[model samples]
Target: MSFGLVNVPVRLFSATENHDVQFRQVHEKDGGRIKYQRICSIDGEEVPYSDIAKGYEAADGQMVILSDEDLGSLPTRTTKEISIEKFVPSEQIDPLLFDKSYYLEPDKTGLKPYVLLRDALEKADRMALVTVSVRSRMTLAVLRVREGVIVLQTLLWADEVRKPEFESLSEETHATQKELAMASSLVDSLSGDYEPDEFEDDYAEAVAKLVETKIEGGDITETPEAKGEESEVVDLLAALQRSVDKAKAAKAGGASSSGASEAAQAAGGSDSGSDGGSDGGASDESDAGKARKTAARKAPAKKSATKKAATKTAAKTTAKTAAKKSTTKKAATKKAS
Candidate 1:
């Protein structure tokens, strides 16, 4: 809080926290919750919290016990003050060095200086380098403006940053220009502007979704379960080829299914039309059969009328012959008288 004659009374706030899903150990046989107790290794006994003291073991196997009173009496670099040494461009700090962050809220008395410092840092686009002791350990930190508030970000020490000592990378490796160009082209094709909001904690989301699903479905696991899996070695190039082929096959399968569905629907329409035509043809044949039956029923009546007319004509001719013979016999009788 004391930086170059500018003092600001501020309260510290943790900037980040873990949101990972957590699990606890449990007894497998009886489904009981398991508890851990701190036991003294040398004495082979359980120790109470009041009897436990912070101890540091030296290489010579000597344990140095430090009580809370001893730690309180120790001298520290800061007298409850955040000391800002200098200001530097923000880019000079490596992201790897960043450890933790805290937001500083100004007290009622120190509001003006906090605003002044916040405005100055924002205008200059720089981060204030500072040193603060935390948890009995002093570390490097930076002060910057975030959301109109001052944020203190702790940094790791140079010795804390481990050196890369991988044997695989220790040997020199070379690539052809063509390979480099192809890799660059791949990167270019896939390059996009970063948006932090678009990314999410997939594992946490999946866990939440699973819990929600189980709650809604009224499903709960009673005991721990064991699962099995399988793995195999495959050529990298062949795997890529298979992936591409699989994607293409899936796309083609989807298209083919759509086409088949359409064809089925069309065939159904055609079948309906064909069934209607068959019904119509059956109805026409029924009408034609009725007409033929009517014509056959009238033929017998017409034949009976023709036979009756022939009989009448024969009777008329016989009567005319009898009349002519009677007239000839009367004339002959007159001639003999």
Candidate 2:
């Protein structure tokens, strides 16, 4: 079904599902069947479904029972259509606003319409804010295309999210200006385009594989390892500097690898055109040649930097120890004299 001004063709389907193993109620001792009881809160009495009534307790333990007809009498806008209200930049919506995702498929004849809508959305880089009724519940949703398929994600209302007060958090002044600058530089150096494939549900995959192993009659065991948790840094500046340095190193490694790969490709192409007889040798030679040159140029600079840093650190430590020893000796001499 197509909807709204954008003509988004959406066939609603759930995006997520529960994968947990389900268990039924049973007796603990003999493993017999167990039954659940619906009891009245005020009295210690069991109630049958027929006798149960919905009630709201007011002051002084006063109660009012609401009938099915009475509940239905309440005013509500019940429209089954996923009505899109407006289009907005996807970035404008806070991630906390999203609740659940659903796959949306176009009707058989709605393919062209669907593509048009998808392309339009992709071009504008916006998501459609939609209101939809599902299973007697009204939901606010954001609609977008994922891999050429329309996806509708249910959203939580603004009031549903809790706001954090900045004042409640501890205010600690730390991190030197130099550290902050270095950290920023590192972040910039390592920054790259986001590829969703780069992230994976490792925990989910591990759990699935473990389940498979258990099903195949493999024994499961747990290994305990000492957990080393670092204390929260009060020094923000120092932490930032360390982060920057780490980012820079990672970026340098990535750049070097990319350069080596490009060089290898160029060499391979050149060697391939020259003679088909030595293709295998050519490819290997090209790869090795690039690797050697990259290592020769980059490794020495890295090693030199490390050596200088180590030297400086050792000198500083030695000076500090010597100063402490001299202070102690001066105190002893003064007392003896």
Candidate 3:
């Protein structure tokens, strides 16, 4: 990495790992793996991987083939250093702009300069906005410290993020202070420090369990889909109040705490058919305990039923108001004619 006259030799390593479960296509009858062949479209013949070359098509239906030598001759192909442009407050960069992250390790000779830069950035509480070339592409990036190590994070171009263009979002809406207070109460009830280690991928675990059950020749019972309790329209204020009540109940070890969770979910959505409920936490508890918890949670379903009725009443009132306005306008126009 280079900053003006100072150069720091460093190595880059990817900072994240994906833990998604992978699957392969196979023949169901014979249990054979499916395979694919690359065939040339012009001649309809199978082509070897060695014969493939990168090609770019233009708007005029012309193909431009690029070879290894042509790519090597490009200015950014052999870039081996990060060029720091300037320092800016870390908050200045939007989290949305962040792409891939890499850990930067200093070379033996660069230790002093690396520490100098890292310490400076830490003390200033800023990030070094820089340009870097990776995989023959020059892109914007930032250098920041993470646990005493200087980390490099790539940024997406400004045009990459799409602008939201929704009519509903364009309209202005206001909330009453009572509603705001209830919402704040709900937020406070659910507030907790974020600890990533406390969470696990429950879906992945379920898939693995299914596979294990099949291997052991055990009967696999399909899980029933959750009923669409969240599909009904709800009164926002009432839902929020119920959610706060539920949170309090849960915190106080009240028997109706489970009902509180459902009320909270209802509060999150409106009559516009928005989804409200979120998936529950990781499946780390024992099956018996899980069953007990699930049984206890049934009270929330009854609580949400009340919101459904409230939503229907609101919808009826809106429909009646629109009908009355239309009727009055038609009568006035007829009388004038």
Candidate 4:
């Protein structure tokens, strides 16, 4: 890696590894592995991997065949060294732009300089914005310290990250200070230092266990599906308050109650109208159903009140019109006499 006037000879190693279970595609009848061949569309002949060349299809339906020689002559050839451009505050870079990461180890000759750079970065809380050519493509990358080792992480180009165009996100929304306080309390209740060791990849472990079971002549049974939470458009303030209370209760005595109970308490009288429905006898009505029922009850009352007021106003108008007509008729009769 190039660092100003000093060059640090370093080796790059992948920072992460996948631990997913692997599967093979095979013929059901004979258990033979399924294989594919590369065939040319024009000639209908199978082509060997050695004869394959990269091809790009144009907008006008023309194929552009690129040979090894043509590709090699391109400007974006791999550079052996990582060139540091500048250093910037690490917080300024968005984590969303981070792509792939590699651990950089220094050669014996460059050990001192490597330690110096790493210590400087950690001390200053900055990342070195660098450019590195990898896989025949020049890409922008950053060098930062991770667990005392310098890590080089590639970044996506500005255009690669898309701008979200969600309608709900564009719409104006507001929340009361009370709701915010409750949400903040909930967050505080659950806040802790993130330790990666505290979590495990359950899916991977389950897959490995399943394969082991099959290998041991065990019968494979379907895993029980977890109960899904009912979709709800809950009152934000009520939900936050419930969450905060639950967290506090859990912290107090390690005793906890079901979320359903909390949701029911939060809903209060919202479920009253639900009894009139066809599923009124159903005790397992969702919180969303309760909210809907509450809205239904309120809407009819508002409509009925409006209608009654309108009817009374109409009756008064009719009586006033009749009285005015009688007075006008009497005045005309007296004038004529």
Candidate number of the best TM-score: 4
Among all windows of ten consecutive residues in candidate 2, which has the lowest summed lDDT?
A: 223-232
Q: What would the C-alpha RMSD of candidate 2 be, to one decimal place?
A: 33.7
The lDDT values for all models are 0.69, 0.66, 0.70, 0.71
Q: Report the C-alpha lDDT of model 1 over 22-52, residue by residue, as the tens digit.
A: 8767776754557677899998899988999
User: How do all models score by TM-score?
Assistant: 0.58, 0.51, 0.58, 0.60
What would the C-alpha RMSD of candidate 3 be, to one decimal place? 34.8
lDDT of 4 at 75: 90
TM-score of 3: 0.58
Q: Among all windows of ten consecutive residues in candidate 1, which has the lowest summed lDDT? A: 225-234
Q: What tens digits encode model 4's per-residue C-alpha lDDT throughout 60-143?
A: 999999988998788985678899999999899999999999999999999999999999999999999999999979999999
Per-model tally of clashing residue pairs = 1, 3, 1, 0
lDDT of 2 by residue, 77-136 (tens): 676578878899989988989888899877776788778877988999999888887667
> Residue 159 in model 1: shift from native, Å?
1.8
**Better structure of 2 and 3 per TM-score:** 3
What are the C-alpha RMSDs, in order, of all predicted structures? Answer: 30.9, 33.7, 34.8, 33.6
